[model samples]
Target: MNRFWPISWQRGGLSLIIAALLVFGTVRLFTNAPEVALILGEPWEDMRQRSSAKIDPAIPGSYWGRVITSDARLRLIDLQYGFVTPRARFFTVSFDDNERVSSIRMSPQIEPLLLDDTLKVVLDLQEQWRKGGWIPIRVNYDPPFADTPEWRAQLRNVNKGGTSYWQAGNKYQVMMVVNRFKDERNPTEERYLIKLQLATPWVSQ
Candidate 1:
């Protein structure tokens, strides 16, 4: 028997070692690489105040004209299918490897309105996008997949809604996700979530 190490002390030391390893492993496992996203319809000042990313003067703060990224021309494909609650006043857009916009998301601060109103808003916004040189490349209704299991189950049990998709472009293409939901209390009433994606342009090295 080794008198230098007691059974109780060994057990205690082993437990501490295990705990440290768990903490270190967890930090290594969950930490993700920091990525950048563009803030559409927001001034550089506002975006700068919100995030640590370097902001460039784009559309004079109304839109992010340019952003400084480590990769320079980074692809923003991940944001296309990603979801974020709309909050605050601006929309964040992500870019692709070719330095083209890939995704756009508005803060959830914007509340959902009636379906009719929502449609009107969509049409109006589309018009603005057109003015920005975006042309419709693709249009569809209802996402091929359900928003979520809960939402899907609700759609089956309560009401069915529309998820209209519109892809437009000129110098760059963009995809829009317009989700509409019917009010449970008043089926006549509705709400919506709108997301946009910039087409990832191919770039040759």
Candidate 2:
């Protein structure tokens, strides 16, 4: 038994070396592990030098721009003027990416001159136009009329007689005009113009 112990030791050492070689080869096949690559950098550099690559121009310009992988579908039309006021009544217009008129909003600036002596002209005009209830009437009153008098006289007349007589010379008929954008390709990038006009009906006292 003691003479056979050296033979057993020599066999065990050879088995250990073979097991180490198998493990190293298996790791070399499966892993892209950086530390292992560093150990074999020279061969990897030679492999990369032999490879060919080209640049693509379709890449986005900025980081934020790059993050958007899909194409843009819609854009807001820039209105040169922000908001319309009574001193500046106008129509608001917007276009889609295809350059079609997507939306149009009429904004009238009811100037003090237009409704100076009237109690309900602006409100009545909007309601009547929207509801299609009544034909608008124009009025021209003589001198000594109050500027925007209270609704007392008009309301009292309605309560008593079931009909009201608004001062003849104090009413003005208003009309609005709006211009929409024309159709074009790539509407968002193209320039557009819109115009708004307000006309008053002639009145006789």
TM-score of each: 0.37, 0.18
Candidate lDDT scores, in order, read 0.35, 0.22
Measured by lDDT, the strongest candidate is 1
lDDT of 1 at 8: 38
User: For residues 101-144, what per-residue lDDT tens digits would candidate 1 score against the true structure?
Assistant: 33333312134444444445455545555554444442343332
Model 2 lDDT per residue over 157-190, tens place? 4222111112212222223211122223323432
Any runs in candidate 2 off by more than 4 Å, and if so which? 1-88, 110-121, 133-205
In terms of TM-score, how similar is model 1 to the real structure?
Answer: 0.37
Shift in Å, residue 194, candidate 1: 2.5
